[model samples]
Target: MRTSRPWMTQAATRTTAVHIHHQTNDTTWRSYMTIRRAWPCLVFGAACLCPLPIQAQSYPERSIRMIVAFATGASHILAIALSEKLRESLGQGVVPDFRPGAGGNLASALAAKAPTDGYTLLLTSPTIAISPSLFKNLGYDTFRDFTPISLLATVPNVLVVHPSVPAKSLKELIALAKAHPHKLNFGSGGVGSGSQLGSELFKALAKIDIVHVPYKGASIALTAMLGGEVDMVVSTVPATIPFINSGRMRGLAVLAPERVASLPKVPTTAEAGMPQVVVITWYGMFTRAGVKPEIVERLNTEIVKALRMPDIRASFAKVGLDTAPTTSAEFARFLREETDKWARVIRDADIRVN
Candidate 1:
């Protein structure tokens, strides 16, 4: 309206072009930022869909700690052998850390509190199944806090008496106990040990009254029996094998379904007229609950493979143990049955521990 100058017209046109350029740049930058923010979400969704195999493949990044329930005896032997085999296959060190007390509860408690990661493993005996019934307070729930990996091995418990006892057979021992109710005494690893429970089950089944003398461990109890400090002991075949062979102790009967090769002369409880008196000391592997299924499967596979190896089997066999590997589901079912059976025995025998 004022003046139609060439310079003014040119200036207005240039201003319009600059405004358009700024608008275009702002729109492009917003689109880029939206994509950048969404990148992590897209990756997370993909991972959720296929996580198991990847997690398993990447697992066991470091050495694993195997908590041995007992420092000595068949459990320790099995642990060392199994750990060696696992180390070879898994390419990670499987170290045995002995925590022997409370009839295996100390190790169980420590294992139960460990992270749900696959790095911590527990190697235990039937005490795991027995503790729930024998103890008033436990730190972990057997079924809730643990995931069974596999049943590694089983050793037969033999009722062995010192050389001084006159009884030669299971029946003779029962009659002798009947003649003198509290004269004959039995030694055990501890109050709630498998040896004690096995002996209690025997007492309940045979209707005999024998005093129970608790020792720090089964080996100690066996030592006591050897020294004639205790009359008899329900001990593992391996611990009593040398003594029996050397005439230091007499094997009354083996508490198993079949007689062990190491003690072939020893009669099974079934064969000894007490079919209900079978007590097997078993070793199994477990990890804290909530571990990935893939990791569990991996461990189960490796254990099964290791147990099948001839050398491993031979090593265990030499010590009176049978390599009894089983799948996770099978072991879990077996554990449940063992727990129920021991619970009944504990309740009937009135066994209690603080």
Candidate 2:
């Protein structure tokens, strides 16, 4: 065999000697040195993987800003109640920043571009689902720009008619509409408002053609109905309950799956033989996409907890809102369903907003 090189012989001898020493001596010091050599790598790996947990634990280190889609009305009330409750639970000021404009799009755009740090949140109604179909140039993608946290509450819309309309029930109204297609008309808050969509859904399912009269706001539309300016209207329970109770407006059916407690006598659309006409003004929480899952989970937990509180539930109910807390995944699926359903309704009805 060829003679071994000098460097190879030296390496073999050193390896043999180290092996012998390892076998004969205690390995505590050797192990310590090995760990010391790997300390930086171990720290780097941990730093990469452990940050989320650490951040989650220390989250809400400061006040949180809640962007309310509507400056006033049910949404604002819901935001104030939710913020006050969250402040109590999270020990941080959860401030409601009203950014109402452009049919709730201004607040949505602001929320979509907010940092994914869980500090800025959005409390909005179904406008998030309806805007993509109603407006052609929305600043944010409804599905892509936000992460749904939870559904806070819902207020069902009740279909009511002027006492002069002579429709005592949903069936009577449908028959009347079919009997006189263009003669019957319904009023709404605006062209793209929930009341309009609810009436459109009702029209599509019932196969009737009731002319639409859009007012500046739902309150105005209800007032018009009260004054017999419009034959029918789909309005929130709180706004129209007094009228219904006072016999100023005839409640045909509530556009929801179940009869509301406030209007226990009013049958739901489903009970009225049209299960597809359910339309409720829903409020939910959202954050910018890419927020850490841990933070989202924490927020959802606290929100659901706050919603279930007796005081919160009672407060919401006073305004005809029912506590409807849902998990994040469930809320996401619900949002998608709402978006698709409204999209179809808008397209079929040729609904558009300028």
Candidate 3:
């Protein structure tokens, strides 16, 4: 209770100050250690919230898969040719899976639902564009579910007739058809096929009533014509070239932009006096929807480059397919326009497949 000596008091005060300083130091150190221990958790929580960016350079690091929706036909030819070119360009092999059934619907559905990682691609013809409107319960949407890469090639459908048909030219045939509506029956591979579409388009544009006789395939259709079962047949140039050369079937017009080399003597549909009767079975590439725009652009660039190579062109030309290269945007627009165009034709013609 008594007052302490001044020196001792001063020393006690100093001791208290030293004790408080030590407590403060200990509290601060504890707080710092708590933060240090929790720093990893905070960082880990942040990382879990945000994913790191993937390097785009490592893209296409594996073999790409191409889905072709046809049998061993023009679509197959296009897929093989394009795959060969892509192998040369991408340093990776393109394995083609031909899922040919349901009017190529099976393949299109699978391709539409495939992963949008630039690995699984679809190489199909205008059938992709035509099927949407041609069939009512088609599972996949063409433009919505697909990312158009490029328009690969275009093959003309040569309109041919059995020698029994007296019509020598398209004008003669149209006049004959108009003279005898529904009397002139045209053969096609199947309903909603390229041949059928072409034949239907001709019927509508020429305002003729040509009945459609669908067969199992173009060859079969042409065979029917040879047997005199059908009056005329709309078939691929390659399929009907031999028949035309043998003088069994007569070529009236080529439904293409210009005269095909295989049938140079045959006038184009436009040249035949119907400018809107171009029926090209075009082949194009598409990927699954929701693909990154940059990835699509890259794919389009590579594919267009592949199509331009002379080797690719010559190989395709051998089969009467002209390698048609177009930008992604252009191809998309073309798809849309063709869809609308074919839809109109299908509706007007009342063409449908169950």
Candidate 4:
């Protein structure tokens, strides 16, 4: 890591120059004598004050690019909302690039290759954690390729079905699947995506075999479910809430540990008797590995602050994302745990991208 900052040297030189001129002044000399008498305490205070210039100038000197590992629209609606808040708070432009393919492996690799100057970031979910085990040849390693920044939110997936489906509850759905194994199909954003994992976990816990139908994106997947192309879809509540309310889709159960505020009537997967299928989509921020620890801390603090804002909180709630922030270290540990947990699910369910 680079130990010296050019900006800090410039600021310190300016401070020292201004003080040198003041040394000749009578009033300044008297003040200097008083400070020198208390030099031990005064020096510590002075050094603390001197470092602000470097910190202010070094971070985000230019616009930042945040790569979203999903397509445009509902899949990334929450990310764009959070990015807008971050831009307002940091006073730097924030640009988002949505790269959708290979279950976000393409975007993750692109971010891993970018410079680790804090100018580039990745906005994504646990798929970054889950992909390494699912694909035989993923380009980048999640733990090795990036530094975990902060956790943005935990989005719960809802088990939604087309109104035409005979099953009205999770219990009934499982029974129906048991009666006709491999006949029911579940639509997902794509293979190895969070929706896929949610559905996979569901199948594992329920002891059922629902055919997986991977679509290009969430919209298409939801379209398939609504058109009866697929029997059910395990997706985020925000994307399916409108349809559920409109009677186009019915909520069989939520994959969250607890029922969501928006859908108080619906039961969680555990409440519906399958306690092992609890899965929620969690999004976290990341920068390429090798970014300074101080830079990571600064970004994390700002992001947490941005998420706490009333408008930002409301915007997140509007889209069914709970505004919860986790420290970088905490998020890193969580990522590892989630990766291990999902890896077991993928293996147990015999899930694979190809």
Candidate closest to the true structure, highest lDDT: 2
TM-score of 4: 0.76
**Model 2 pairs in collision:** none
The better candidate by lDDT, 1 or 2, is 2
Q: Please give the clash total of every predicted structure, in order.
A: 0, 0, 0, 0
Model 4: per-residue Cα lDDT over 180-280, one tens digit each: 99999999888777788778777766678889999987789999888889989888777887898889999989775567887777787768876546566
| Per-residue lDDT over 1-354 for candidate 3, one digit per residue giving the tens place of the 0 to 100 score | 110000000011112321211011223324434543464455446446754335334556889999998868678887887787778777789999999988788999899778878889998877788888877777899978998988777766778988999999999999999998889899888887778877877776677788888888777888899999999888778788888999999999987545766677888776887655666667889998888776676677678777767888777777766666766776786687677667767776777786
Residue 41 of model 2, lDDT score: 59
**By TM-score, who's the top model here?**
2
Off by over 4 Å in 2: 1-52
Assess each prediction's global lDDT (C-alpha) against the native: 0.78, 0.79, 0.74, 0.73
lDDT of model 2, residue 198 = 86
- Lowest summed lDDT over 10 consecutive residues: which window, candidate 1? 3-12
All candidates: CA RMSD (Å): 27.3, 22.8, 28.8, 17.6
Model 1, position 314: C-alpha lDDT score: 83
Candidate 3, superposed: residue stretches over 4 Å from native: 1-56
